[model samples]
Target: MIRPSILLAGAVSVFSPFVMAQDDENKPWTVSTELGVIATSGNTETTSVQGKIDAKQRLTRWHNHYIFSALFKEDQVTQDDGTKTTEKTAEKYFGSIKSAYQLESEHSNFFVFGSHTEDEFGSYETYSTVAVGYGTRLYNGETMQLDAEIGPGYFRGERVLEDESIQRESGVILRGAASLAWQISPSAEFKQTLSVESGEDNTRTVAESSLSTRINDAMQMKVGFNVANDTDVAPDKEKTDTMTYVNLVYNF
Candidate 1:
């Protein structure tokens, strides 16, 4: 089992020196919360909910980001005995933290990243990774920016089998990621991100695209699509999963 507390504590310890040297009062944290919900009745009964929190802090030489998100869905189904019941159809939780130290260059940094995920109905029941890498700005323009990173990492995960058995897998991995952000207008923004982890046992890939339009100074509406894929999976499981959501975001 990959312990989240251990990884978080390690990250904090690695960055404690920078944290202590910087004056936190002058550098405030920025946070955003997003929520999406859906409910249906009548012919078909279903409910779905998603929530996310994103936080960031910037000091003189260090930048930190934290993210947590959860999704849950339930559906009403008719059983063999002609009885109707509600059953959970999907459940997933994910969290990640990244801290970067600015180098002498204008847009370059060294970063440490850690993430964990739990999915009740996916190929992998639990997965976690830690990596250290160098990142740099690939493009800087008036309305668009791009950043990319590559690193060697380690990952451990639990895989579900066709027989309803759990198998543990762990290995060294090479990770690469990139992000693109475009300011379409003063109140509208578009973003895309992709990440891949290649290991001995399996290769995992994730991609997300989102567009947000500001409704006010502190609120916005966003629509996003996310996809996750694994090269290796159980016989009865699909290799890919996708989600589309519309959410309300509050920023502070």
Candidate 2:
């Protein structure tokens, strides 16, 4: 099992240098919280909620970020007897922290990243990965910025079988990630992120795209779409799941 205390200690050790580099008066932390929701009624009754918090800190030669997100969904059906039955369709959460140390080359850095995910209704009950990789800014222009990273990683997960038994799988994986941001206007921005973990047994992929527009000094409105795919799944389980939602974001 992965221990949160160990992760916290590692983060503190790596970020201590950056902490000292920044002046106390002007802290380098940036934090944001977001909430998304969707509901449907009539022929099909469905509801979903998602929440996320992101925090980052930047210093002279290092930048560190932490992110936490959760998603929950439910569907309801009206029986012939006039009773409503509700079932939880999805529940998942993800947490990760990444720290990058700059290299001599421009727009290049080395980073250590670790993440944990749990899903009640996914093919996997829990999954964890740790990787160290080189990341580079692929493009930086007036209105666009893009970054990419690739590395070897370790993955461990417990898969849910059709018969309700859990199968533990652990192996080496190749991790790849890319992110792109576009500044559409003074108050509107678009962003996309894609991540993949390829192992001998299965390949897991996630893609997310969002557009956000400023609503006030600290609030923004956002629309996002996300897709997840697992190449290997239990019998009768689909390989893909997709979601669309609208959200409110608050920046601190």
Candidate 3:
């Protein structure tokens, strides 16, 4: 299992150098950290936590993005022997980085992306992917914007079987993604993102929708829903997973 501290440290190490090297006169880096937690005691003991970090940097001709997220949950349950014990119910970690080179057109760019995921209780134990693609703004309006991208990529994944055996799958895939953002009001915003990767053995799709309202100059309240689906999975496993969360976001 991947620890949250390890993931946080890796993210900071990866971005610290670039952040420190930037000049004051240059465009500043935009970074946001979000966290949510739930805990219960007495009658039932349960704990859940989610955290995410997002960072973006734009230079004269390059745009870069970094993301890291983690989820963990634990519950106290009675065993067959009537003994109560705390056990982890869910754990997941995900990280991705993308860099785009700005073309002559302001809305078009070429990008290379890579991502990795680890899920202790999902259909897939681990997955990693890399791709190169061209992206462009499909629409730009006063209050909304849309962007899309497509490319060929490669992925490697480990699937868990009914017998608890691990099966490794690797193949080329076609990936496509789109995102839309709307400014609902001066202090509120809504965003939706979707992505799909299709290969010979399986197809994976993910979608997220979120709404955030500014609380202060550097803080916001956000609610989000996320879903992930796999076309093929073990007989004992489900093909889809969903998450709903409310978080506090700190931006800089």
Candidate 4:
């Protein structure tokens, strides 16, 4: 059963008149197929299917803006019984945009951003986070990237009976991600990723790595793993439970 909000989002997408009228030079889109698994400490494993969309446009000369993103599956879930099920799972979505300014040919790029994320197991909320970062081209084709931010944010829980804590941490945090794209042929590409994320109260650390291949102009596929830990995993209990998710992504 799809949630009301998921149905609403899809309806808006289908009826979005602006989506088709936007100038040829004004929009972009990406779609993908994703697969992954989530593990909690020594228990429960859930696998999932994932998909993503990204678009960009230059609103001005000083700031060539782009929104890079993706979201995927409700069930590709790996249950304790070791069977796959898509039932009772929730849909996930994420979108973000940034206005970047260039300072040099290969040395600097800076940006400010705002984003929204809705995970299969979490709430959907808007964020007005600001980031200043630098990017430099490396190895003639590969690139290195880094950024930092501070902001107030919101989150929601998926399970109604589960804990309901909406307001997330608000403080300075550092974010970094790097991907190496290998040009295999004129039309095909391969990518590898490395990322680390941290936030205030020294809470919630995320580390991830993945590999993907671009099969065509509209579609791509990925497989990866991610691990997350928090300072206060169980608010009422003294124990902390870490989570891991093995992921596969498809984009078109």
Candidate 5:
């Protein structure tokens, strides 16, 4: 049987990459790295880092946005039997490319994007996923906007647990995200996001909000909070497990 703590780690690890991959660029590229510490079950701690590089270019009558992300996790958790287990050190990579076609008006645009994720866990297990989505944005003011998207995806995943038990599961996935961005001024902004995801034994619903402040033309800092509940996520557990996390972001 998989432990509860290990299940939680897997849940958190899967969705953490979406924080920095949703940018829309106008030929202005971006690159940045972030580091932070997360408290894993009371006294144990996990260090998380993410690096991103993105660029945008125009393709005739349409514009394309391309962003790539990499994430690394280092941490340890004490198991239920009082034994210490270092959660597998894993590296995650992600790519999202969005393209929009102009519709003669500034506020009217349409786009479709594909996102890919690959996870490598120190030779224990690896998984890959691909999702494609269609969305539109309503841009008002200089930076205030709203964007919504929906997608269907699939996962090709296999896992090998510490007990030497292996499990293979892959199924249909549904995802949707809507974000509202408010530019308070030239140097500050606020954002609220709603995301829904449904997978095999997991149906996750999350709400997040963030605040961003620019330090200069080239750098920005932000912080956000996420509240989520997982229903039927693990077959062993009958009820939902609600989780909350605080995150900080940097853009350069």
Candidate 6:
């Protein structure tokens, strides 16, 4: 078993030097919020909303990142008997935090990360993960950047069954992730992220892509698409889910 206390001590010991080497004046924090919504009426009635927040702080030796996002969707449909009803088709939320310790080599670091997720209709009531790994910048240039990371992790969750009973699942897993950023122009940028976690029970993968165009110094318009897949799921459950959004982002 991987003990959290041992992991914490190891991470602290490895990152302390970087933290001690940082100068005060160079540290800065960046934060942003994004909101999106879609609505339709008449023949088909639907409403969906999503919101996300991101924050990052970087020092000479350490970088920290945090993210939170939530989505809710409901649609109106007519029953086979001709009656109309409003049903909630989707609801999900996720949050994560990570910290990276800069190594002596440029563009390389060791990181610790954790995340939790909840979905109203998903296979699990709540899913959580913790990982530690090494990360490196694959490409960095004026207009584009790419980074990749790999590590070992643990996953534990309670799943919902058709009988309304809950079953617990826990396992050790491997995690791999990559991110890309492209500065298309002064006022526009594109981003993509991919992550995968595999364990004996199942493998999960997620991909997200988005483009943002600045409307002003403090705001931007963004279009994002996301896909999530699970290699193993209940017979009555789906193997994949996808979402699309048009978001307005505000920087603070």
**For this target, which candidate reaches the highest lDDT against the unseen true structure?**
3
* Candidate order, TM-score descending: 3, 1, 6, 2, 5, 4
Better model by TM-score, 3 or 4? 3
What's the residue-level lDDT of 43 in candidate 3? 64
- Candidate 6 lDDT over residue span 1-252, tens digit each: 111211110000111222322124364666677877666666777777788878778878899998998888778878999998888988999999999999988889999999999988887768899999999999999999999999999998777777757788889999999999999998999999999989987788999999999888767888889999878777777788888878888765
After superposition, the stretches of candidate 6 with alpha carbons farther than 4 Å from their true spots are 1-27, 162-164
Alpha carbon lDDT of residue 227, candidate 4? 52
Task: Assess every candidate by TM-score.
Answer: 0.89, 0.84, 0.90, 0.51, 0.58, 0.86
Between candidates 2 and 5, the lDDT winner: 2
Q: How many backbone clashes does candidate 2 have?
A: 0
TM-score of 1: 0.89
Let me know the TM-score candidate 2 reaches against the reference structure: 0.84
Of the two candidates 2 and 6, the one with more favorable TM-score, higher being better, is 6
What are the lDDT figures for the candidates, one per model? 0.86, 0.83, 0.87, 0.42, 0.57, 0.82
lDDT for 20 in candidate 4 is 25
lDDT of 4 at 113: 53
Total clashing pairs in model 3? 0
Estimate the TM-score for candidate 4.
0.51
Candidate 2: residue 113 Cα off by (Å): 0.8
Lowest summed lDDT window (length 10), candidate 2: 5-14
Provide the global lDDT of candidate 2 against the true structure. Answer: 0.83
Q: Between candidates 2 and 3, which one is better according to TM-score?
A: 3
Can you tell me which runs of candidate 1 are displaced by over 4 Å?
Answer: 1-27
- Specify the poorest-scoring 10-residue window by lDDT in model 4: 5-14
Ranking by lDDT: 3, 1, 2, 6, 5, 4
Candidate 6 lDDT score at position 198: 94
lDDT comparison, 5 vs 6, better candidate = 6
Candidate 2 residues 121-212, lDDT tens each?
Answer: 88989999998999999999999999999999999999989997899999999999999999999899999999999999889999999999
